[model samples]
Target: MLAAAVAFLFLMQSAPAALRSATAEPRVVTPRGDLAADERATIELFRNARDSVVFITTRQRVADFWTRNVYTVPRGGGSGFVWDEAGHIVTNFHVIEGASEATIQLADGRQASARLVGVSPQHDLAVLRIGGAGFAIPRRVPIGTSRDLQVGQNVFAIGNPFGLDWTLTKGIVSALDRSLPNESGPDIRHLIQTDAAINPGNSGGPLLDSAGRLIGVNTAIYSPSGASAGIGFAVPVDTVMRVVPQLIATGRYARPALGIDSDDEINDSLKRTFGVDGVFVLRVEPGSGAERAGLKAAARTVRGVVPGDVVVALAGKPVSRFGDLQARLDDYRIGEAVELTLLRAGERRKITVALGAGTE
Candidate 1:
């Protein structure tokens, strides 16, 4: 009993010490005077860019069958940035697609009704205008050219991802000249690939450089889970600068057109059969630039369709496929004249065609 009592007392005495050591307070270090230079720069960049970024919400009109009443239903939400001091907002075309109405929410929580100004489905870009007595235009982002952008350079993306407003993500430019497919037209070329965490709601936000200049517009991401997987593509600002002005002025982007239709599958099959290496012109629209330039289209005969003028090159650039021709045309203006090298029958012919505006 004496030994048991002594042991119990010894255990009781050591328990408090063990508890004190286990629950000891962690050492707190005093914070420095301010953030580091790079940290300060990043914070300032976000502060300046946030005001330019806006949240976009859209709605669709739905009619009830029983009551015959029309109601507005919430469609979706995305992000955009101010294009200019005139209250022009730029966003992805897919965001406003099929939306009957849209609203723009500024960083200050001010909301206004937005009207669709124009859309370029080929580039997946759209412009919206907000104007009223209470509508106050936010600061516009400083535009930067993507032509001089270097891979691995630091970039910042400010957007509303998953409805989270004004979220900023930092990353580096992963690549340049990346291409993404467009549903309405040819591929969107010269995309800026980055590691920025761009999500669905970030579709139309500006991708800024280290200097807080708009370098690109965040568009899509390559992810299996429908979230950011470190691979995001942005439409380069050079293309944006070229298209937005035209859109704002004319309410549409007039792509230089050849007015010829070529089936890719058929063209590929014909190329393989003939052992040729050019885009086969399947059909030419009457009164088109192609038709006026004396370009002939493939004709259906007794055995099979006979191949017509195969587009070999454009403006001294070799066109291996239909997309190549479209991409080449993107570089030229609608009224510009281009030389098309064609392979017809057994000879190569050069023809000049003044480009015409393409219809969406």
Candidate 2:
């Protein structure tokens, strides 16, 4: 062993250049040809859709109890996209729910102050506007319809998940028409479920189809540890198209209603009392469209105060709960007449009622 070590040392000293040449050279570089068609498509999609995404940072003003002085503290943020060239940015309502101010970080690394345009907490959507007039977007996210989306369709999500800006994740549509509730908002129905890796900062980001078109807004993830669980939900773009214009115009979603009053809890109680299923109508607005349409509410009869007209369906769509009915009504607008199927005295009848304004 000693002789071998001495010989190796002597060889290193005698032929150090040969040893250095053997050890210092790197492996030859291999030539990788052009990317596959699917890979090229994915790259093209990311390049085209990236500019439409933005990173949002929010701040909240807090007052010190001892000095009574207010200070702005950094609040958590989420992702959004450019709604128009007018500098209107759209994000999840919960992202800036209690924020006093927010900052918009564009894809080109330019920061701009933003103002809240409006919010729809029920839908979990909010809009912000930059003070730029006729701002032109270098790239626009192609809007696509979500009503025809099917399970197992390729979907892409671009966002700033975990504060990592402009991150892209790919997955398939895990499900459709999914309904889930947020702790801060009402039950959101007709959601598009994807297996995409959506985390906290990914909220309000666009969920695009294979053609690089906006299909849904990445909103919530079904995670117990507040991280990605492969089950993420997004608000459908169809709902977005309906709610955003109203929000931009009126600062709130003027959801169409029928002017009739009812409650889910009351409906449940009435279901037991009257031995039927559906939303029980408590009262119809006096001289309203519902009353004019001959809609009846629970009233006093010779036997007792029995259930009146219980809504079973709307416009050929079955409505089993109050939220179901609420979600169905969102598809219509004010003054639009829709067929309402009701259960009157254990008999079924359909009536065409013009919807009035409703509060979701």
Candidate 3:
């Protein structure tokens, strides 16, 4: 038996190499066909929009409590996009709200210091300028109209989500004219809602259309886990188109106002008292547009509780909340005469009032 086993081993050792090992040959490659049209379109969209998107890093000034020394520390970062050929960057106001300084990284691996140009906290938008000697010009994103956007249309979001630089996420426009609560001021109005996987670092990034045109600025997400839960919001480009140009021109954006003083809490109280829903006029600014238009304020007279003019509509659109009034005012520019439907003495009256500079 031992002699027979030795003979078998000797025969196996002399066998062919293919029989001794599993690595005989490589498998045949399966060729992949050309990319689908949609895939190609997505790739082209990212390619065209890549140069316009920028990664922003910010630092915050921190003070030593014991030593009383102030120094800067890395605060946070988000995304932004080039607005024009002049190196103007448009981003969310919350991105650089308390930032001491910021740096912008371009697509070509170049970094430059950014200076705040202007900001509209109410709109959650800010404009920054970055240019010095030898700074290369950035490609401005093609602007698209958000007012004409339709639900379920293909939308692309280019941002640096979770510190992943220049990441592209695609989804459809889940909805439009959405409003999100903003800590800075009034609720952000006319936001374009999408399911584009926008995360923490996606804020201020450009939300592009299928044609690679900028339609919105990615702002916030509706997530409880601090991650993208398939719901994201962006400031519509129509508001961007109006606010960015004004931010570039002026150091501050002056929102158009009716020049009437009103409060939400007080308005709620008035609503309970008067049993009506609208912006309750508490006080009208002297010599202002509302005053010139004969808008009256609530007064405590000897006759009893004299009700004020309750603004109910703007340009025929019903407005029920103070935020609604502010949001509606955003649709028109200052100095433009807009029709306001007021509820006075339980009767509806329409008045044309020229918008004045906002005092917010």
Candidate topping TM-score: 1
* Regions of candidate 1 where Cα sits further than 4 Å from its true position: 1-26, 65-68, 272-275
Provide the RMSD of all predictions against the true structure, rounded to 1 decimal: 4.3, 4.8, 5.4
Overall local distance difference test of candidate 1: 0.90
lDDT agreement with native, every candidate: 0.90, 0.88, 0.90
lDDT (Cα, 0-100) at 73 in candidate 2:
98
lDDT of 3 by residue, 1-360 (tens): 999999999999999987877656888999999999999999999999999999999999999999999999999999999998889999999899899999999999999999999999888899999987777878899999988999999999999998999999999999999886654456679999999899999999999999999999999999889999999999999999888888899878888888887777778887898899888888898878998999999898887667889998888888777876876787788999999999998899999999999844
TM-score of each: 0.89, 0.84, 0.88
TM-score of 1: 0.89
How many steric clashes does model 1 contain? 0
Worst 10 residues of 3 by lDDT: 179-188
Ranking by lDDT: 1, 3, 2
Error in Å for residue 304 of model 3: 11
Q: What are the per-residue Cα lDDT tens digits for candidate 1 across 42-148?
A: 99999989999999999999999999999999999899999997889999999999999999999998999999999998888999999767566888999998999
- lDDT per residue for candidate 2 within 158-234, as digits (tens), equals 99999999999999999998887444434688999999999999999999999999999999999999999999999
For candidate 2, the lDDT comes to 0.88
Candidate 1 displacement at residue 358 in angstroms: 1.5
